[model samples]
Target: MFIRTESFSQYIRQYPVVSTLIALNVVIYLLSLLPFIGDPIRNFGVGSNYMIAQGEYWRLVTPMFLHAGIMHLLFNMFSLFIFGPELEKVAGKARFLTVYFLAGIFGDIATFFVYDSSYLHVGASGAIFGIFGAFGALVYYTKKMLPQLRQIILPIIVLSVVMTFIGPNINAAAHIAGLVVGFLIGLSIFHPKRIISWRKPKLKVVQKR
Candidate 1:
């Protein structure tokens, strides 16, 4: 009982990291909406092959927090809300950030190489997709949750992929890149027992007379 209780507490504690990520993205989105900021901010976002070729490497990282518009922002934030906290709980704060950005940046890298010179993209979806992939990994790694994951997350993933292909202006490469990177990270990083407890054998108290 005590172990379970402690596990729950640790899980709850991980939420603030995810919340901070959401807050940063929201704040950046709000900043992007300012009168003069829009144009300048777009420069920070992922762009066509030419833009990256011109030494705008920062675009790889910045696009993770950039959203095109309010609807885009809301949709991505909703995804973050759904996936971030749970992932943070499992991955812990540092690994969660690593998974998020590593996948997101790799998504940008993929877009850089795969798409046409005119293609441009922004939004948290790539990173969020990474989170989704992590969730999928978590589901698979956790034996008890396999049934629930198959019933829930699997369908959502498939639907999301279908929607991405059909959706206008979607960066399919970014989505695919993030998903792949995230899954690999999950495979390497996720370990259930560490989160639960690292129990050390209590020394047997031999009362030496």
Candidate 2:
């Protein structure tokens, strides 16, 4: 299910929401690379506890699209690209957007409350973790029916949580918060019944009586 076999055009067509999000991230990242406007864009968009406290509320949402560097952009966008389409397929466009943005905003909100006023962070790791959490919820709801999903999803969650704590300069608070929010949203909204088998049904020929 995680494997993407779609062509570039097909991918864009099939997963428009994911494609738009990836495009937005890339466009914002490119804008941030500009010598003149780059620093300004980052300064304005980055999630800053001080600025947030000072009433710059949009920072929460903006940082979802902002990135500190090309690597940061690539990593987050890649994560979105890989995991997003499936969720989008399951959740539909609206719920998927709700999950993505809410998870990200809540992550920023968590960071705001957890860190001191001097704290500054930029990246979509929180949102990406949110996607992971949504997958976790899928695994949870479908465990009895889809036992194989545990093997596929559990390790990714475990490894991601481990890396979150051990990795330098990582924002554990946002990641954890986003994950929780995503999982909760998933549990509340996602029905196990919505999950359908990806394999094509085989047709059988009946012998004439």
Candidate 3:
């Protein structure tokens, strides 16, 4: 189900929401590389508990699109790329966006409330974890029909959770918060009857005459 065989244009057409999100992330990351405005953008967008306490409320949402470095950007975007398209396909565009943004916002909120005022962070890890949570919910609701999905998804979720804690400089609170929020959102919106029929598209092989 996770393998992507679609051409680039086909993938974009089929999953506009995921494509756009990945594009936006890349654009924002590129903007942050500008010599003049780069630092300003990062300073303004980073999730800073102190700045948030001082009424920079936008920091919560902004950090979802900001990354600390190239590796950070690549890792989060890669996660989103791998996991996001399926959820977007299953959840539809509007619901998918709702899950993505809400999970990210709540994750940042958790960071703001749980961490010290001096704490600062920037990345899309929280939002990506939210996608993971949504997948967990999907497997939970549809496991009977797709019993094999549990075997596939469960290991990923567990490994992700373990890495969240053990990884140095990780934001465990945001990751956990995003995961919980995504799962809850998924439970509310996802129905087995609706998704049970959904299947990965089969790639047609061209025959040589």
The lDDT of each candidate is 0.78, 0.89, 0.89
Q: What is the TM-score of each candidate against the true structure?
A: 0.82, 0.90, 0.90
In model 1, the runs with Cα more than 4 Å from the true position are 1-14, 143-145, 191-209
C-alpha positional error of residue 205 in candidate 2 after TM-score superposition, expressed in Å:
36
For candidate 3, the TM-score is 0.90
Error of 1 at 129 (Å): 0.7
By summed lDDT, the worst window of 10 consecutive residues in model 3 runs over 191-200
Residue 98, model 2, lDDT: 83
The local distance difference test score of model 1 is 0.78
Kindly list the per-residue Cα lDDT of model 2 for residues 1-209, writing each as its tens digit. 88899999999999999999999999988988899998998888989999999999999999989887777788889889999999999888988888899999999999999999999998888888888888899888888887777788889889989999999998999999999998998886665444443344778999999
RMSD of 3: 7.5
Residue pairs in clash, model 1: none
User: Model 3, range 1-209, lDDT digits (tens) per residue?
Assistant: 77888899998999999999899999999999999999998888999999999999999999999988899989998888878898898788888888899999999999998999999998888888888888889888878878787887889889999999899999999999999999998987786555555554668999999
